[model samples]
Target: MSTPTRKPLDRHALWSLLSEKSDFWTEVNVVGVTGSTNADLAEAARHGAEEGRVLIAEEQSSGRGRLDRRWTSPARAGLTMSFLLRPTAPRETWGTLSLLTAVALEETLKAVCGLSAKLKWPNDVLLDGRKVCGILAQAEGGAVVMGAGLNVSLTEDELPVPEATSLLLAGATALDREVIAAEFLAHVGAVYQSWNERGPASVIERWQRNSATLGRHVAVSFPNGRSLSGRAVGIDADGRLQVAPDGAGAVETVAAGDVVHLRPRD
Candidate 1:
């Protein structure tokens, strides 16, 4: 398939969209260059950037993801931003925040682009069974900085991998990156507020509904040279994965790992 031509986004137009929805996003900071928005927000948190402050970058030289994987961000083809928050939850509940962000992304994509994006355990968003978005979270002191990258208009030739796709490539031709970003922040802010008011249980329930990993045979690779294979049941309140291993007597709760959803060998 040939790549579709896209219009260059103007910073002023982006600002106008954000400003129109100022109630949700108060402090919008845009930069032309940064190592990574997540890193920038972490530094700002160390020095105390206000809560609800958002940092966006047009290009990231060193974007990061889980397991120290490099998030390949090529110029303006993707949305790269980090949002700061100081939730009142205890330190142990911090891990659930990433899943909450994924839920928010899934909802926003469906509502905005009519694309039913699903969460692939942890924080990846997949469209048509291919990765289109990724989320990363960091905790500093008592605050959390959540970073998200979405491929808005990248073509198949520009995609980082064959298993990766963009909104434009997946039949969302009318979608705009700035519009998507603005709407996403609004939805995310609401989800964050819900988590603050209700609890992790509410967030987990919403996450499960949008999860693609649930009910799938999967393998989780741990850093300590241990691994587990099972069918993903669901996510618990503490954000641990509940997996039912094949021929197992009991379900296993996985706290952390890189989960790969597998198909039964034919």
Candidate 2:
């Protein structure tokens, strides 16, 4: 862990911040460490916990990403949290939350930190084509728990992977986790309300604007040990990646998979 000590988020201050933004968030709580914020919040939601409960963990020990991929972050080095949401919209559209959060992070980072962060299809936030954040959404008892891990101030040697980066590595001027989280949740509140009222069309448009996947050749590995590669053409209605294979062929919508962007064909 870095030598810099980070104070755990003050529940009073965090709740105050959330309240000023909107009533959508019911509570904001913090934990020093946890296996996964998503898991903890999901359990709470299952027992009839109200929506808009936000849980932040200063450190995650057994963090797992999509497809059970391991995700780890040093103490106080990243934003690791889960927000509970109960949406009246069709469950089918829930997948868009990941994409929506990615856009929210981009908006917050660019506005507050002036970092040129971008989004890869699905739910990865990248700075200079390297991932700086990942999002995962899980359902429990008619509610959703959306967790996001945002890297803030990791040294080059502390990075979990070569393909990953942190704000510090990306030349971010500000490393204040609370500021970033507040700004990001504001956008999340707005987007969630908009999506529930209008639909996902506008959110999709905003996500596309920050997309680094569109127009790139990608290989998507499926759970069935299958992989598909093609040029990412668009995002489907269900928020899946639309890929047009090499040469003229039908476009395939990938529902879930590990996506690797391949270099442009020579």
Candidate 1: what lDDT? Answer: 0.84
Q: Distance (Å) between predicted and true CA of 249, model 1?
A: 4.4
Which residue pairs in model 2 clash with each other? none
lDDT of each: 0.84, 0.87
TM-score of each: 0.93, 0.95
Give RMSD to native, each candidate: 1.8, 1.7
Identify the candidate with maximal lDDT.
2
Report the C-alpha lDDT of model 2 over 74-156, residue by residue, as the tens digit: 88888999999998888898889899889889989998888988889788999999999999989886998999999888887
* CA shift of 82, model 1, Å: 0.8
Against the hidden true structure, what lDDT does model 2 obtain? 0.87
Q: Tens digit of lDDT per residue, candidate 1, span 137-187?
A: 898887899999889878878887888999888887357878888878887
